[model samples]
Target: MKASAFVLLLISGLPAAAIAQPNTAQGELLRRGELTGSRPSAKAQMQAASRPANHASDPAQQHLLQTDINLAQARAEELPNLYERFMATTRDERRTWTAPQWDAAGEVLARLNQRYEQVRTDLPLDDRLRVRSLQGEFHTLRGARNVKEKLE
Candidate 1:
């Protein structure tokens, strides 16, 4: 009974050891060029080394990109304030915003839209879509204001 139990234990452990063992056949295949490792070849490594480094890490380029991003963010932040101010005015006071205030807002919107369009390719998809949505809102607000002005 003791010998039988020992034999059963050894038998159970054998399959696990077999599964854990690395296949020597894989090494043979690699020696014959039938299998490849994940690492790039020497030629590929040399080509990659010869290529120019990414410009994004350069201080001047990074500064310029950051500046543009800041300007875009500032413009985006201003939109909400402008909308709030426009909404705050009474119906009687709507005309007060037309010439100077509304025109300035329109100019800002146009400039922001142009800047966003110019950089859209550089921006991530979500940010590009956000800028487009802002542009649409600007147009909608401008149209509503125009209609109100015409009604008056």
Candidate 2:
């Protein structure tokens, strides 16, 4: 009976020893910057290595980034015009908007929403908030238009 109890205690302690052994291997891997299962793919690792530590000194990359920013800004500037057209047509009192008019407005709103989402990360916090507010307005207008059509 004493031998059996000793064997049981030894078996239970083996798992604790196994758990402790992992710290040595994991610590060495951590020191070497080589993660096991979660290591980055070879392509991503190569890209990361090739990138300069100080990116601001890379003129070509800087130019490309600036060009992208300029294009995004240009696209963002068009939002106001699109929003104005949507409001003008939807708010006009001379006649109820037909299906085609609603379709056009929806298309414009979709475009505006897409552009905002694409460049929202680059926008200032205030601009991001404003874009969200504008999106909400677009959704409200769409709902109101739907209700009007249902009533008609």
Candidate 3:
């Protein structure tokens, strides 16, 4: 039983070491500029877009967009506290949160990012940079959320 347990542990440990090694084939190909994945068909991409076909604004769509804008603005306003809470909760190395909590945090971060993008576009370059720095906390929180989900 003891020998079998040791063998199991050894096998499980091997893949972690493998992950530490660089993939030479991928690295070389990336250096050569060879790439994979199909380019989106223009027609298909157009059809896939959520924007209206007529390019005429629909009231419902406009309302939804406005709501998105509002939510982002609100989040931007309260971003500091949200980040502080997230950090405080996750500060302990042994603390773990459920996937839902992390996912919600990620969603909030994405919303805050959208808000930041919109706000930045309306500001001067210098102000945009400052705002971006302020907004970075949301991105960090979102990343932590994703990490928590994956760890779970």
TM-score to true structure, per model: 0.37, 0.42, 0.32
TM accuracy, model 3: 0.32
What stretches of model 2 exceed 4 Å from their correct place?
1-89, 92-95
lDDT of candidate 3 over 60-144, digit per residue (tens): 2222223222333344444334334433443432136455544444433333343343333345566545445444544465567
Give residue 30's lDDT in candidate 1 (0 to 100). Answer: 19
Residue lDDT tens for model 1, 17-94 = 888644422211111111122234555445434533223243322222232223233343443333333233322343
**What tens-digit string does per-residue lDDT give for candidate 2 at 1-152?**
99999999999999898765433222112111122223345554454345333333333322322322222234655544444444554555214656665554453444344344454445676666665555566557667877877998
Ranking by lDDT: 2, 1, 3
Candidate closest to the true structure, highest lDDT: 2
Rate residue 62 of model 2 by lDDT.
Answer: 29
- Predicted candidate 1: what Cα RMSD to the true structure? 22.2
Ten contiguous residues minimizing lDDT sum, candidate 2:
24-33
Off by over 4 Å in 1: 1-96
**Which candidate wins on TM-score?**
2
Report how far residue 57 has shifted in candidate 1, in Å.
Answer: 29
What is the Å distance of residue 68 in model 3 from its true position?
Answer: 14
